[model samples]
Target: MIDIQYSAEVRAAKNDGTPIVALESTIITHGMPYPQNIEVAAQVEQDIRDAGAVPATIAVIDGRLRVGLEPDQLKDLGQAQGVAKISRADMAACIASGGTGATTVAATMIAAHFAGIEVFATGGIGGVHRGAETSFDISADLHELAQTPVTVVAAGAKAILDLAKTLEVLETLGVPVIAHGQDEFPAFWSAKSPFATPLRMDTAEQIAKAHATRRALGLPGGQLVANPIPLADQIPSEELDPIIASAQQDAEAHRITGKAVTPYLLQRIYERTEGRSLIANIALVRNNARLAAGIAKALKAQAG
Candidate 1:
């Protein structure tokens, strides 16, 4: 049997058949500083609640996989240091060893599926890193999307990555990447990218229908709803391009590779953007949470 933990709020929601959105805890543990991490996480959860869905923030604590978190748990997690960044590779080991860890996009999708939640909200998905052609460094997130049966809502692949390559990998893996409310795929902090979305969806009902249709057809994977961040909150692609390039250059100069690359690049970008990147990240996550709630509601209603 698989071990799982549920918060009081999540347990109640399950009992009542309420719509719920699965949230990743890495944003709290690895994405930012404590107070801001907890604060932004709380705001995202509340945003989902206000949009008519319960938020289930997933993490692994003391050898058990937790599908939701209490307020105190969230705070403690934010303050915890050296938390393992759990993904497809290490999530099981983290749980079996009684280790506490934060869930990345891939781990969150796996946990969400285990919890029977159909939608997950996050700031962005990871993808092919720059120079991946030589480094072959691709994120497990693309593969998780290829197999997990939960819909993911995000601004898009992280701008620090090679977005075009990321989209190509997703396509080749038989994953559906649908841009929400636009033809162009989103570029994390930016609302627009040069590449067009592989698919476009305008409403929660339509997205829900697509998800259900895939399952009905005996498909094995889920959909990626590439929700663009709100226009007013976006940093714009033009403004972000040079920043991303400089960060990548810095990573290369520092010989950063593997897991350390993302954090290093993001931190560089953060400093270069004068802290505006974090602001945009918070805004986009809240937006994705709201859209994910709507999709969850539609999925529940459709099932009913």
Candidate 2:
């Protein structure tokens, strides 16, 4: 079995059976610049803590699958150059090759489950990219959600994706896409999208019960809690529509495809919105962290 290195805080939490929420590391390494990346990472972790749960920020550091990072490690990772943005496909290779890598949504879910964590918080998930009919650019996150059995809390799929198609694929996969406290599926930076959710749970307790119920029934997958960004913090769908279209046009013009598509489109959107998209992203992520912490607590209570 592969040896997992848990941070001192996470180790203690595990020993005491404290509820823990897993966080992905790509946001630190690839989401923004040095100090700010670290700052936001720390803030999200603290958010989990304030909500009565521990945070396990998973990453591969020098070939080790670290379940949680030390503050120093977090700082170094934030400033580290060329840290590979890894997912299910490349995570093992990076570890085997003794490389440093940041975990994306799929990889984080895999790691979280392996580390016995049932909940994870992230800003957004990748999904059916636009033009998937031809480019066939679907994300591994959907498949991971179908098999990993770790609950993921996100604002929703990133706004740049084809929201309707993403939901359709999740439905086809038999993954429960439960929107938290709302009927409409959230759109990352925006609180509501055009698509309605297939499922909606009003409280973390309800969501947690569903999670446990799935496990008891021998289900093979996790749940997606589409936690909406607070209305005051959201960018609003109407305002983002034209900006998203312009960004997509730019992406096509630049021929950005495959894994490069998301970052490129996000950068374009950031530029167009004068960084407000990023501000909303940070807000939504922290909100998700808080909500995931609640779910973790509820799950833990159920287990007890």
Candidate 3:
């Protein structure tokens, strides 16, 4: 009934019981410009393959849920205009209407679970907005993690979000926020945040075991693997804080509200930072892909 279609590689991987990592499509359709978006997406997919797992970039094309995209499909998605940012709430509607859309973190997790994939790689997860208490503008991604059963690997919540509130919400939802190889939680473009992670994991095997243990204990939700951006590529918290503040102010000045806020802020930051933020974003995404692949491989090995 889901009407899901898989790429040849994804289908083969599924049939063979091989490791496969789920990737969200927003990074292509909404995160960056065309050509570069497609190129970076392809590179991330290739990173998973190089690490011994298949990549399934989830999206809805013409109302059908696609587990993996072909090269042409990826290109089209990158170039398409006015693509809907589909989350759990809108994914079904998009499919029902036969619409073309890109999956966000929440939608990607749902699709991955439906496809029996356990690990997802992304640049970062959405979280509590800076003024969420008053605006009630929290992302559905938080609640999605509370119920979904897929492990998510990312640099961390976007720097533009209220990291403290995001971590608090995750804690309340009983989701494990495991920082990979560090005690401090990452802040997307920055390698570290001021807050400490609830849990720390040193290796992919440990993170994989934590995921398996959660399932064994009948835990209701997935785990957040907060892998930090490589130190070399990081912009540092001190440098990014002021830049983020300026971008946030710009968004408020422009009256950008709701979903428009994130893209507006990111675009402003990208310009303010002279494209360094985008470079760091692409690097972190590749880093996440590599880690997710390892975690997927470990999960498969454990199953066997």
lDDT of 2 at 257: 79
Q: Write the per-residue lDDT of candidate 2 for residues 1-304, one digit (tens) a residue.
A: 6779999999999999999999999999999988999999999999999999999999999999999999999999998998999999999999999999999999999999999999999999999998999999999999999999999999999999999999999999999999999999999999999899999999999999999999999999999999999999999899999999998998889888787888898998999899999999999999999999999999999988
Q: Report lDDT (Cα) of residue 242, candidate 1.
A: 93
Error of 3 at 146 (Å): 0.6
Residue 115 error, candidate 1, Å: 1.0
> What tens-digit string does per-residue lDDT give for candidate 1 at 207-238?
99999999999999888999999999989889
Worst 10 residues of 2 by lDDT: 254-263
Given candidate 2, what's the lDDT at residue 166? 97
Instruction: After the best TM-score superposition of candidate 1, give how far the Cα of residue 152 lies from its true spot, in angstroms.
Output: 0.3
Please report the candidate that would top lDDT against the real structure. 2
Q: Which is the better candidate, 1 or 2, if ranked by lDDT?
A: 2
lDDT per model vs. reference: 0.94, 0.95, 0.95
TM-score of 3: 0.99
